[model samples]
Target: MTQIEENLFSEFWDKLNGATGKGFGKTVSIDQDIEFYQELKYNNGVFAAFKVHRMQNDMAARLLDENGELKSFKQWLNDVQTIADHQVEQWFRTEYDTAVERAHLAAEWRQFEREAGVLPNLEWIESTSVTPGKDHKIFWGVIRPIMDGFWNRHKPGDRWGCKCGLRATDKKPTPVSDLPAGESDEPAAGLDNNPAADGKLFSDSHPYFTDHYGSKKNILLESDKLMTKYSREEVRKHFQKELKGKSLMLQASQGLAKTISVSHQDIKTITGKPHKYNYMKNTCCYWLPQLLKKAEYMGWSPDMKGTAVPGHGDVKNWHYYRFPLNNEDSFLVVKERMNGEFRIHAIQDKEHFKENKLKNPFEKR
Candidate 1:
């Protein structure tokens, strides 16, 4: 392999060894490992770094899950790398500059972790006692600029990744104590042992599962189709009524649709209500979970194996199996889906949801 490739290989090796122990390198100090990873993150694209970083986190999550059932770190590393490589090929394209793709992938991964309630503990988000691997910091640093570039244009609070959550519209990070039931205490690290299995993550007390679950795309599509019965203005009005004085951005972008924000209103011309207002920062829409699920269902998930767009997290994040319905509404739809019964946090069922007979309503339909 080329020197760069060899270094990448060694970085991967070190990560696996300390984490899964494929024995790719000598028992270097953590400092050495971190340094190697930094080069990999900066030199490599976001997707590569993401793939590498995710493997590390996934290993930790698994260890937590099985109570440390790992047979050997080496075996785990080999096994994980093989599987990760296969999965990466599915979403990535080979045409784009690998570096750019890496950038996008890294950003998306960070977004995903934050939305899924894992980012808080992620090396990038918080100051943990454990020093981050070089690749880990490199990956975040690379994506940080990209994220910063879009901070003002897009509601910074809203850009959390897929999987239904309040931040889809709001970018302001919520405290872990504030996250809905079953939501991870640490947003970046993911769950320890399938929090869903414990009947907590998706219970009646659960925040996002109360209203729906099948396919987010299906939900958005269905909602969009339902909107066809109305007009854009009408849909906005629907949210106005549903959100009870909340303002939403009608961003008709590609790849994803519907980035909402909650805010109070201010008055204007000859109208009953205010023309504009300060959107509530707590609730917003960055990524559509139901919509993503639908895209995944439709085989429209963006390619991750090949080259991706530059400036990760910017418009044109990922292209799914299928293209957007049109530029106006790509993989997402703009609707007040999180209203009332649909609002995840509104209907969380924590302690004894099953007893309350609040089985995942989405599972049935």
Candidate 2:
């Protein structure tokens, strides 16, 4: 018999077992040559011989391949592992995009409901992620397009569909503060009766906006439905863009009567004194670029022009004309008092904006 026939017959005998029943002295033999080989007639029940044989060969091939090292099986296993990793990464990407899209859609739906004055049964399910909370709250006005895109293109179980079912639960209860002494855990005995809980409850209730909130600080005023109704430029003009910087001085009195008082008399004594020679007395602030250019104008040397300011050679290559003036530089001319309004432009100290306190533009000698 051939190798294929031998493999087939081997599987056939393994399946045949326990022949003591109704067939009185009857016996069955394995057949391999017949192409129409259907069932193996046993004393008990019939079995599909060809099908079982084929399955045996396939299983044998798999086991042998798996047992061998650096074979086709190893290669196939590696490929399968790679595919599984790729699938997991793809799932994470899809989930992340969906989370962002959901936030945008929720914001848009809320806007629509507010505008129409019709309360819809649709409540938003937020993704259980902390990273997007701040972003979700901001730019809420411009998120309608993103929401519409997801809503129209996504179907159930699609990449953008909400499948994770991950939602935020449990909010902290407002604590009671300034509560009066009582037998039971009750509110304050004050006239208002509602004790402020840990001061945080009132803090949360108070209107809080981010550093850039309601401001065109870095935002460009664009024409939109909301912008048209409530002009962006008009609203942003009043927004407080200034940051609260470190206080050089301290307040003397407590609540209501509080006023800033200079405690460090030594600091005032050292910094308040006027310069003796007054190098800036006759200098014009407009000619600052000319003074700066003494170091170099792109590549021109000081010998080709006037005397270069010492130690300013490093800044010569710097494109100050294209660059915004340092706010500290405002102090340089501060020494050279200008007769005009003395208005400080916001752009002068774009990066150095620390509190409202002015930085000395002129480097101290």
lDDT of 2 by residue, 1-365 (tens): 00123333333323222111111122211121110011111200112122222333333444334557545666655545544354335633442343233323333333444433332222223334444333222212221221223223221112233322211213321122421222232211111111111111011121211122233221212111112222222222222121122222222121111222111221222222232211121111222223322211111111111236532333211111112121123222111112211111111222332223422323231
lDDT of each residue in 197-282, candidate 1, tens digit only: 12111112212222233443443333322222222233345445655765433332332332433322311101121111101101
Estimated TM-score for each candidate: 0.16, 0.18
Badly placed stretches (over 4 Å) of model 1 are: 1-6, 9-51, 60-67, 72-83, 86-88, 91-365
Please list the Cα RMSD from the true structure of every candidate, rounded to 1 decimal place: 25.8, 34.1
- Model 1 scores a TM of 0.16
Give candidate 2 misplaced runs (Cα > 4 Å): 1-104, 110-352, 358-365
Supply the TM-score for candidate 2: 0.18
Query: lDDT of all predictions, in order shown?
Result: 0.27, 0.24
